[model samples]
Target: MTQTILYARVSTSEQDLSHQRTQAEKAGFVIDKVVADHGVSGVSTRLAERTEGKRLFDMLRRGDTLVVRWVDRLGRNYDDVTDTIRTFINRGVIIRTVINDMTFDGATKDPVQKAVRDALIAFMAATAQAQAEAVKEAQRAGIEANKGDVTKYRGKKPSYSRDQFQTVIDLLSNGAGASAIAKETGLTRQTILRIRDDQPAAETALVKWGM
Candidate 1:
């Protein structure tokens, strides 16, 4: 019998593992098991290097399905992510992502289909790496800007935590309105607008406040 396993990598204590699982379940994936690495920096840690990540390799078998929040969860960067996904597919383990409802299968032998799938994989992996680099750069800049008198760097502290800020950004990317996001995240409409209008500033605020 085949099983669907959900894999999550939580970078900080603020990140919610249950939120990832909830998102996957909401996407209609009937998960048989969940493996997670807590407080693991996905940007710097290879999948195989993670404790739970290693278990994924040993636990998964041919015909099993692996689900992740995004391609970035699979590895540290473009090469690592692409290599990891390819490795799973080659092992007859199907890979799926909740964010984009993406599926990768190695069972397909059609040349055109294979080409399209490979191209998509490369594009997504490259995008994931690019986003990670951008966030790292932003955090560096934020830290520099807050070198002295961090409280004054961004004025009043933000009402939201890093995880809440992330949730707002995710919803905004999906075209959710400020009012809707405000309700969903329990943030004020003004706060949502502020974050939507100036995301970098919001991120800087979070960093300055050590959120």
Candidate 2:
């Protein structure tokens, strides 16, 4: 029988693996198994280079499905993401994303449909790379901004970590209420509201504190 597997990459040890699983389940994916790489930098390491990520290529069968939080989980950059998706699709594995409920299947013989799928893959992969670059740049800027007088511009440290801030952002983007997000993340409703009110500022606060 075919199976569905969820693959997650957490950048820091503090990031929660169960949270990714929960997000997937909440998005309606009935996962049969989960493979994750903790403390893995998705922006620097290719999927094939990851410890648990390599297992995905071996464990997945042609009829099985591979699910991820987003395309960025599959690779380090645009080329890596595109190549990885095409490789799986060519193997007859259906790839899906929880974020947008996006699907990419290679079973279609129709040329037009294939074109559309390939185009979408390229677009998403490029977008993932762009986002990674943007975050990297933002972190660099934040670091530089506080280098000279750490006390002067550092501002107050945020109560939440980087991962928690990201979780709040993701939940908020999914239309989750402040109370629900606070309950899930173990954060105060006021903090959730603060994040919801200004996501960029929340992210900046986390980066400023080096969280």
Candidate 3:
């Protein structure tokens, strides 16, 4: 029995996965598993730390079918997205999209059709990145609207625990770089970098909380 798997992600937990769910269901996918990365930015093309992204590897098999709202769901950028799709296709997995009903399959007799499919995948991956940028722009607008309002906290909790973050620092201090740390921990290099470069205040919180 071939199972169809649905993968989805939203940059913020506040953003609903319902839309992707609805689309996949409407497109006739049974959705054996829903792997999602909430509050994950699509601008990141690496399949590094996306909770669902990693799950996709374990859940997928040669015969299983993969469905997504779009290619962007797999990646935040074009090259990564294309590489991923091609790898899946090479592995004998079928990739399908709800929008445009785009399909990329490796089982084709004609060389021309294969070329066309490859080109389409490349184009769609770029489109996915463009749409992700749009999503981020919209989120920025919403954040700006509530700027300086301090009355409300409108964001999802961090997936990494404070202890885990400090552990990241400790590991770094112990001579671990981003790549090494990511391998040591389950987190992505980008996530570690984000903690290091963007969130210095988080370090104080870690110390104050005894993490």
Please report the candidate that would top TM-score against the real structure.
1
Look at candidate 2 and give me any clashing residue pairs: none
Top model by lDDT, which number? 2
Over the stretch 68-161, how does candidate 2's per-residue lDDT look in tens digits?
9889999999999999999999999999998878999888999999999999999999988987787677667766877888775568889987
By lDDT, the better pick of 2 and 3 is 2
lDDT of 3 by residue, 1-211 (tens): 7788888776556656766776567657778877777777667636656766887777788878888876777776888899889888888899987765678878896999988988888888887677556545655664577687533324444556644664575566455699888887688888888876645444333322323
Q: lDDT per prediction?
A: 0.86, 0.86, 0.70
List residue ranges in candidate 1 displaced over 4 A: 152-156, 169-175, 193-211
- Against the correct fold, how does model 1 do in TM-score? 0.86
Colliding residue pairs in candidate 1: none
Clash list (residue pairs), candidate 3? 11-39, 12-39
TM-score of structure candidate 2: 0.83
